[model samples]
Target: KLVDYWSDPDRMKQSYRNAVNKAKNKVTTHQGSKSFAQGRHEFVEMKAIQDESSAKTIPPMKDRGILDEVLKSINRYCTQEQFEDLKRQHALEIEEKRKAFESQQKVLKKFVNLFNRQQGTPSSQF
Candidate 1:
């Protein structure tokens, strides 16, 4: 009977949905697991990277199976109202790159200033 129960397509679907929901915990729409999301994001990011010589300006990335199972689980198990309450979390990853660039500029500026000062100094060994 237990085997027959799971063998039923509808029952199997329901069981799978239940399991997915349990894993999702209270998540409504966003990522289920942080580590899972991070790993998937990294994979997507790597795949999205464009060749240096490519004319494309921006790396394309969207709904790239990063949360396919979670989204499907939500659609199957979650109420529309509850799902609507869930929001995707987005971090400002670009800020880090921009900050690094700014620091490099500061270092370059200091080096240039020192170079100019040395250039202005007369040769002492003459």
Candidate 2:
């Protein structure tokens, strides 16, 4: 599932832009707060406080039996050899996606650093 996400350059770029926008918006939202105006570290602390206050509590799983049944159904549908081949293919895809994502992140980091330098802004702001 994550491999599918990492495989799409357009989607990744969109997500990156959205994250930057969110960060800008966060700064804007906190502009009136004392901590935000105080310092960068204070702003980070304030954000962490807000995040902790807003964090959701996950509900515990109701049943483990369903998982066993799911595994059984999957095994029932595929031969051992077919399952092994699928697993190998999935692993290869995952590895390829991980490498691709790492390279993309490195390139993006360099580009962002260069852009930040040119704009006379800290990369941490975004």
Tens digits of per-residue lDDT, candidate 2, 1-126, equal 899977799999998998887787544543454453465655465455445445633333223322332224443576565679899999999999999999999999999999999999999998
lDDT by residue (1-126, candidate 1, tens digit) is 989987999998998999997888664445446565675665565454433214455543334232342234543565544455453212344667788999999999777777777889533423
Worst 10 residues of 2 by lDDT: 61-70
- Candidate 1 residue runs with Cα over 4 Å from true position: 1-91, 121-126
Best-matching candidate per TM-score: 2
Q: What is candidate 1's local distance difference test score?
A: 0.59
Reference-based lDDT, each prediction:
0.59, 0.67
